[model samples]
Target: MVLPRNRDYFQIFLASLSPMIFVVLLLAELGLEWVYSLSIITLCYLASFIFWFKNGTKPAAWISKGKLHIRDGVFGTDVIYKDRLESMRYEIGHKRAVAGSNAEEAEMHILVIKMKGFDEWTLPIKDLIEHGPNLRLYKFIRDNFYNLKLVKK
Candidate 1:
């Protein structure tokens, strides 16, 4: 089966350059006389660049024929079998009061799936998607996985 590509080069480029942009702004505010500020900014920029280059813009793919396989991660891919999934549910946040807060707040959209004979797993869709187009991956998985059972609260 063919997998769709969700890589957004533009987003990757912007993320990679964010560090430099921040550093420049900081330098402008601090001025050249504050050499230590410049040094700190430079160090932060380098670290940010390295992190973005390594983990940004990678897309995940899900394929199913006889079994289901999900490919995602920065360093390696995760392959989960169809039989392993016990239940899957789309979780929404509920309004709840917080300490020193007047308004209620909601949580994030999560896909909680329990593996057979194992502990439950929660996947946050908001954190997983690198770009807008990557949302299609979540829809694809939700639509194609017929065996998915919803967990009852």
Candidate 2:
């Protein structure tokens, strides 16, 4: 089964703006002229499109042949085999806050997978839990993995 990328384009575009805004503000504070600041911001915005927006387009995850594949970036994918897994965990907490909201935050559901000889891999499954077609992924993990740990807050 494949879990396609669930991130929205608008969200990615907004996320890219944060750094651009900061750079422009810093340039202004440094007494740069309006033309120079505009040029710099334009460059930064274009870079964000190339790096951030492009990177967000990929499959979120997929399962095949007793292995789980997680796509993390433009050039990176983490593969977890069922046989090598040491422990599996599901955790919920305030690890990330909602964008542009100071007092309101969303609960992040993270799937923490620990393999025998590798560092633990944590994938935020908030989108999966809320927007997935079904709970097949959750059920598959629960049924296949042993020593499953669930932590809720």
- Kindly list the per-residue Cα lDDT of model 1 for residues 2-115, writing each as its tens digit: 244455667666776766866788678867766787687768877876786666543455465545444444455555567667777655442334458788553334567787
Deviation (Å) of 106 in candidate 2: 6.4
Clashes in each model (backbone N, CA, C under 3 Å)?
0, 0
Off by over 4 Å in 2: 64-66, 71-78, 86-153
Worst 10 residues of 1 by lDDT: 125-134
TM-score of every model versus the real structure: 0.49, 0.56
Q: Candidate 2 residues 1-153, lDDT tens each?
A: 776665788877886787887897789789888898889889999898778777776666677898877664445676778888888886655357788999877655677887898998887765543223444345555655344666776
Instruction: Check candidate 2 and list the clashing pairs.
Output: none
Question: All candidates' lDDT scores?
Answer: 0.57, 0.69
- Candidates in order: C-alpha RMSD to true structure: 6.1, 5.7
TM-score result, candidate 1: 0.49
Off by over 4 Å in 1: 1-7, 21-54, 63-79, 92-107, 119-121, 128-135, 143-146, 149-153
Which candidate tops lDDT? 2
